[model samples]
Structure formats: C-alpha cells, structure tokens
Target: MRDIIEPEFEIDEKGRVLCKTHSNFEFFSQPKVNRYQQRELEKQLTCETCSHFFNDDCFFPRSEVNMIEYDRKKRNAFKCKLCGNKIDRMLTVMHKLYYKEKYNIELPLICCTCYETLKDGKFIESSKWRSNMFLYNALYAIYSLISVLFFILVYQVRIYYLLVFLLPIIYLFYQNMKKRKEIKEGMRYYQKYFIDSNNNNIR
Candidate 1:
C-alpha cells in the first residue's frame, strides 16, 4: 500500500495546505515582483498589460535591441543570459565592465528561482544597502501597523493633543502602503503577462 502525504500546517498553525492550489500559498497570497523590478521593467518593456511583443520606445533605451538579438543569434531558445536558466522575467542591467562605460546590456532574462534567491541579502546588495533596507522594512512596515493600533487607542482616549504625534506616523504608513501597491501592481503585471502567454502557447 502507498503511504499518503498529509497536508502540512502553516508555520504559525494558522492554515493548512490541502492541494496543488495551496502549495504556493504565500507566493500567491502576495505580489511577486518588487519595486526595483517594476521600475526597471517599465523602463524597458512596453505597456505591461499589452499582449504584443514588448518592443516600445521605452524598451532598451540605452542599447539597441538588434544588437542584443545578434548576441543571442546562436541560441535557439530564450534562457537567462546570466545563469542560463529558463527565462522568467526581463532584466535591463547597466554594464560598465562589458563596454567603454555606462551601457545597458539587455540580454539576461532572470528566472523566478534566481530572483527569489538573489532579491535579498549580500547576494544583490552591499552591507550598507542591506542595513538601510532592514531599517526601512522593519521600521516602516512594522511601526506603521503598530501606529494603526496606537491611533485607535489615542482616539478612544479623546486625546486631541496626541493627534499631532499620530498624524506623522499615519502619513508615513500611507506612503508605505502606496509604495506597496506599486510593487504589487508590478508583480501582477508580469505574472499575468507570463501566465497568459503560457496559456496561449498551450492553446
């Protein structure tokens, strides 16, 4: 008799994965792409929602697409230009070492696996960069949530004097949420584009 694999509980025991749909719960629950990728992708590709080939005035502004195509002429299929993994997303990277200086060498399409692994830590950022990022995510993301609760408490207390104190925190929270929305939009844009492309291919 074959053994059954039971559903696994979430780390905090808040939920359980019961099927294929639930396998990537966290990844699905939230946006996939980050802010940096969104800004970069927008700068390179056409309309994020457009089904047409991503060749727009914005695409490869720093370099010629024909030259990039020539570079990959030997390759028969799309793959990560950096690690040779299957293409998941396009990344327009500035290559200082590859050319005279200040050149956009757009060939590498990053796979999702690599994106997840390289998005964090010293792998992609310097120590100072990581430290600033930590401060932002920790200070703003966490403190903003805390401020919401504090706002309610202050309001119930009818403490008008504390309004001055709470307003700044509220403003910061709003800014953070705005940034979060942009990042989420970016993720949704790319995920939908790729998924739709795959579906069309299958059809």
Candidate 2:
C-alpha cells in the first residue's frame, strides 16, 4: 500500500502557500524583505485581476524565482514590466545618479511610468518657478542699468538725486535675497514631497 500526503490547507487567492497533512495542517506565509526592491516589483507587476498576484500589504510570495529570471533577462535586455517599454537598468542607474548629483537629492529607484508622472507633476512646477526667478533677476539688472542712467541725468539737480539712486540698488539687493530664499524653499519642498510620496507608495 502507498501512503498519501495531503496538503493541510488551501492556497488562498493572496498567493499564500499552505501546507496540509493528516497530522498537522497550517498556513505557511512568506517573509518580509527589502521594501525598495518590493516597491519596484509592485510597479512592474501590473495585472490586478490575477489571484496569484496580490498586493504587498497582503500575504504573497516574494517572487524570488521571477526576480532571478528578471535579473537574467535584465542582463541581456528586458522591457519595463509595467508599460512594456524597453529599458536598460544599468543605464537607468547611471542616469539616476547623474540627476541626483545635479539636483542634490537621492531619488528612489523608479520605473519610467512613475518617473514620468513625477516629472510632469512636481518637477515641472519647480523648474517653471526657477525659470521665472531667473527671468525676474535679469529684468532687475536691466532696470538697475536704466536707473543708473536716470541718476546720471538728474545729478545736476541736487545731491539728493544720488540718495534717490541708492534706493533702487537697495531694492535690487532685497529682491535678490528674497529670490534666493524662495529657491531654497522651493527645492526643500520638492525634495520632501518626492521622498514622502514614494515612501508612502512603497509602504
């Protein structure tokens, strides 16, 4: 006679593997791992209807097998899992590092979909404001030059015209300080928002 080994419990829709036996039956759950990698995987796996694929907050397999396969294919060439867009992970990493150094912040590893969304949303606003500030400063410099000519023209009137000329210079200095503060604040807000939003999405 042959003995039979039965599974203790049924595998749920959440990708949990259950062990079932005659003597003892219990549900076996996967363990937690690095969240950064997990978030990247979440963005990649787009099929929501698949029962085998559950959200990370619920019980699910860590997909080690898939990860190994992905790594192998990535070494050769693989498409972005989310959008089916071809991407080079190494080049992506280098580009990310370049931007991080340029922007002075650590950007979370993200796929093209998320990156594009973020760029369109927050980055565009910051860049626009920065550009406006530059334009304002340039205009201020031109105005200062015009004011100097006005001072020269009016110099024969009285020494008071010289004091009047100093007013615009002082105002320009104040505007420069204010613009600098605004830039610093804008950058801080953007960096904080980026970090917080990505962290929340991952968690």
Name the candidate that leads on lDDT. 2
Model 1 ranges off by over 4 Å: 1-114, 117-160, 201-203
Give the clashing residue pairs of candidate 2, or none: 7-20, 8-19, 8-20, 8-21
Evaluate residue 184 in candidate 2 and report its C-alpha lDDT on the 0 to 100 scale: 57
User: Whole-model lDDT for model 1 versus the true structure?
Assistant: 0.39
Quote model 2's TM-score. Answer: 0.29
Q: Write down the TM-score of every candidate.
A: 0.27, 0.29
Show where candidate 2 strays beyond 4 Å.
1-127, 138-157, 196-203
Q: Write the per-residue lDDT of candidate 2 for residues 11-100, one digit (tens) a residue.
A: 333322233321212112333357774455334332122233333221223373245346535653443322233443332433333345
How far residue 154's Cα lies from its native spot in candidate 2, in Å, is 9.0
**Highest TM-score among the candidates is held by which one?**
2
